[model samples]
Target: ILGLLDDSPECRAFKQQLADLSLIYGKRGERGTLVTKTVNPAPLLETLQYYFRQPADFLEKQIHLWETERNERLQSVRKTLQDYPQDVVEKFERHLKMTENANQLRELNNEWLDVPIMNYFRRLVQEFARRLTESKVLEKTIDVYHLTADELQEATAMLPEVMEVRQRVHERQVEEEKFANVTPPAFMGAYPVDAVYTLDPLTLSYLNTEAPNPVDVPGGLGAVPASPGKVIGRAKVLRCTTAIN
Candidate 1:
């Protein structure tokens, strides 16, 4: 079960579990390596209380919808498999079941385990950052991200004069600013860019760097559709957070 982040005795125990779990679980986005943002205690507690008071049936409805969709998909698959050999059909059905189970497990882990653990870790780091800021060990709470876990711990325990740490953070921040303006090449090193698909089949599954089997149109490029329809509008393609802002 997922534990709520709060000051209650049960939540205090959950926080300890998070400290141990933090070594393995973390955000998987661009700032995955950095300490996550803190949850504001007042707002978080208020949100929890509000939800508890309102008792919605959203989960029950969602479960019903999921069951309906799964049944429809399974029926469709079995109908399609009728012409195939018994052994082949059995193998396909088994694979489908395994895939469904794996997907469900992944969802449960992400919602119940990964999110709560990471948020608790975020709360931990942000609390440490606030203390460091108060002691003048760090200029800003966000600067705590520039320090590694070990460095942060040392700073917190030993309370060293962090002029050097400040300098290091400044230099790294400068490098980040420099890279902000630079656009990276799609493919690098000895491998030819055009041959990326041929060289690595897994690249298609992972990276969205290249469009597969692009077709030539009158004035534009035609691409494979991942979804059903097309909506044309003014779209801004942003490479970084600065551009998004």
Candidate 2:
């Protein structure tokens, strides 16, 4: 028989004993030490009972705290992407070069990045092809001027000189355009300038170049220089806003 008692050490000890006895009886026969019987529980009912036993106010407080934390984290990530779209795109392009294949590019183009930007690039390529077709710039031509063996020998002899003149004319035209451009801007002035510069390892290596070995520095191996400049001491690489902290 179980006796009712106040919440004391003796009472707690008695309750523990009762629990141990119940478990023992539930597992084995009344007298046998190793009786085995199986008990099946309904998952939905068990879950409902477990939740119902929890204090409502405590559960509500926990849920509210979890929701607040999740929303704050989502907002932080959104702000980061918004503030660094181009940097994100460049990083993504680098990552793509490593992992992308024909099928992967199709998946990424359909599922990731802004849809409008992808559409614009597709339209641009289509327009370029159309223009080339209209101009007959990359046309496939079947030579209708089939020549005899003697005539072929004669044409071959003249081919080298004709090709040499064409190349010289092309080079002359390029030089003319270079000189015709406006004067170079002063150091302090704001003017449009075209300067050629090397890309960092992240971009250069992605483009399949044998990039220069990175300099050993404090944090890690430094990224290859994007532009050439001399500095006296060590330089810190800051790729993201969070790195400032």
Candidate 3:
């Protein structure tokens, strides 16, 4: 059994700490998913236990390998940058420092702030959903998302009939599905003429602005790898959140 199956206090606390590990703390729409989406801890805990069984130095070795590769790339880039003027090198160094600092802050925020807060909120919602289901106020736990915060509060105070709440949820869900196939306009009531082109480099990158050009390859696809390694496993594509199952 995975360590997560243990009923010990330590194991329970460990699971609680990482309960939101898979939460998508990104923007709205398709990218927005909460810890509630993956309430079960078995999958994540099982994967971690499998890795924990590897050699004692397994993780350390991987980190060392990555550091070596990164240093090599840095030296190569520095050599190439030597051909540029001093001011250019200084500008590059400044940008590099800024990027490193930004990344550090992002990691700090995710680990200490975002993850804990989101998971705490998820637990609260789950507890409320459980109570709502027990009181026959909700058809299911996940249906809690159908009600706005104020509506949910009212539901708690004034125990409404299940049919009435369910009907309200159904209507809202139907309205949402109406826009499933619709593509939103690129700009909505824009004011400035230069607004489209005035975005900073970082903002444009975050928006995933188009590539400068496209390249054709012979019967193959390419992508920038998020990490260094290869693994053979069955791949599944999730087109929508509900498709996960």
Candidate 4:
């Protein structure tokens, strides 16, 4: 009865408690009836009756609403895609190819994934919109189509800028090349001090003297004071690596 009303954790816990109580009753030879005449089956009966009596038109109205919303979303996506320039289109095609390759790699590795490819497609659409907005293409196109100035403004704001669109497409290409020419850093020489500490030596020396005592350098083998107050504890190494698992 509680489960029918709500499937929340508290309700579920209460139901379990009822089951335990029933078990206790059963052990005490009171299994048949724990609480005489306490159960009123009217709510259950009413729920079942209500479900059976639901109007047929209700489902039709819901279906129609869903279909209308879906069509609108599809139309919006199509309109955004149609506005893409030739260069943008070529970049988008390359991104699509990279995405397909990534999906294939996942499949080959037998990895269960939830990569929301539709989201990437939507982002592309947004980039196209932004480009249209920045170029005032949407505004001009709307004007050419005799759409109201207000409508054009609204439409244009919903789209992406041209540079943003190009960057999004280029990002996919960059990611694809990331693993292609991967090489481990050469560890042959005495840790090439200059490369090991990319910061200017003057900058490092200045930071070191800023504190009263010789502070352990940040981004090195030791920790610098991150906060004002001090406490004693065994130092734990915190690794900051960018390697993808």
Candidate 5:
């Protein structure tokens, strides 16, 4: 897409994340689309940066809340330990140390985002904000997904419809966010079938044998394999969606 005539570098989300520029594109069903709307790139860029500020802003709030909660809990632990006998107090102190270790491990998700994933979600917010701001079709950056190719083609033409669809998406997002223990579905399909095929960039190959062979009932769909382990699922998350409390 980098070399494509219509798909400018900024229009591709992955590329946009690197360039910090909005890409001009929308989606239509199962197809990729190039954006037709045009606007002053300068103001659009500013709007995007401001939009991107939201995640970091929330992070600041989260850090303050986390610190407040952590201190309160640590103090509670100390208070509780003081009333206990020596043997119990030692055990509680040991457990407190273990709890601190666990909290540090949790930082791998919270404060220490790296190239692998948590950081990528932040990049997604930036990229989506850039696209929506440049296009000027939606108030919220995430509402960009509510657009169809035809709707985006005319820029502001289908905005009311776009907002209606966005509300629906937002509602679903809210419901999904409320799910706790986060409901793993009854089963994900075997790989190379269902969503797994479309998810992978490389062309997939499956059973090609024409001869009829007796088939047996497949065993239970279970845990990820021990070696070269794989789990297949796709999920979309928004900044508000990730908050535990």
Candidate 6:
């Protein structure tokens, strides 16, 4: 942590957490290192980023200065060659061409360096590749550059005409969210909602089944209300949630 700058609110927050946790849990097995303090690295990071950029700016300025000097040198050599003997003029042209060739190569390299987009894209691809590899869905990862833009859009977008059933449901949810300002219906009858598919160290997928007893498990939210009084035709009872979260 950089001691030069004042600690920000975020640093103070985590420092408090470390103190609280140490007091609450003490040392693990009575031999573990006690959580004593938190270090704020934001100030150090800011200093490093600015300090490195200073040298880079200086080098860029030097390149411009060198180009100006190289042009002046080439003009002076060509002008003197025009008045010299034929042999001298030939040697001067050869020297000029050699320097020009080296300068052109440097110019091309500079062009490549100026293209910061490639650097940004490379970083984006690396992070996406890492996430895909960690997910282990297809047991491997592919370059994001190879994936079409449309595929990425489909994964995030919830257009109404999406073909996938999961996407269609997702689109409906998106539409429902727009009306979130409209509070849920009054606290009457069973306003059964979605099922919570929580990971309890095993496959507890049967958290919302009904048929057999309909009201066996209390934690499973039991059965839907009987909708007493008037005989409201035969509408859906929604005995329990259908799908997973």
| Model 4, runs deviating above 4 Å | 1-53, 86-245
Steric collisions counted per model: 0, 0, 0, 8, 2, 0
Those runs of model 1 whose alpha carbons end farther than 4 Å from true positions after fitting are 1-82, 85-90, 96-103, 160-164, 189-245
Candidate 6 lDDT by residue in tens digits, 4-71: 32378776676566556654442222112222222344554688677786865787788899999989
Residue 137 alpha-carbon offset, candidate 2, angstroms: 95
Per residue, candidate 1 scores C-alpha lDDT tens digits across 25-138 of 533322334333333244545676776766488668778999999899989889977776666566676766765675543544544456556766888899989988988888
Best by lDDT: 3
Candidates ranked by TM-score, best first?
1, 3, 5, 6, 2, 4
- Backbone collision tally, model 1: 0
Better of 1 and 5 by lDDT: 1
Better of 2 and 6 by lDDT: 2
In angstroms, give how far residue 14 of model 3 lies from its true place.
14
Task: Judge candidate 6 at residue 128 and give its lDDT.
Answer: 53
Clashing residue pairs, backbone N/CA/C < 3 A, model 1:
none
Top-scoring candidate (TM-score): 1
TM-score of model 4 relative to the true fold?
0.19
Model 2 lDDT tens row, 111-134: 233443444454554554344334
lDDT of 5 by residue, 31-92 (tens): 12222222234554567767687875786898899999999998987896675556556656
C-alpha lDDT of residue 29 in model 2: 23
lDDT of each: 0.65, 0.49, 0.66, 0.48, 0.48, 0.48
lDDT tens per residue, model 3, 1-245: 44634589887666556654535442112123443233455665678778989999999999999999989998998997887666656766887787777764354455445665676777788887898899898888988888888878778777554434888888888888898878999877876743223343454565568533223356855433222234444455666899986
lDDT of 5: 0.48
Using all chains and alpha carbons, the TM-scores for the candidates as numbered come to 0.44, 0.21, 0.41, 0.19, 0.24, 0.21
Cα lDDT, model 2, residue 183: 87
Candidate 4 per-residue lDDT over residues 1-245, each given as its tens digit: 45463578887676666666644332221133322222334465579677668897877888999999978985775576566555544555565566557544333222111223333444555554555645855432222233333544555565543222334334555775786788867766586543222343334553554522334667867544333333444444545554422
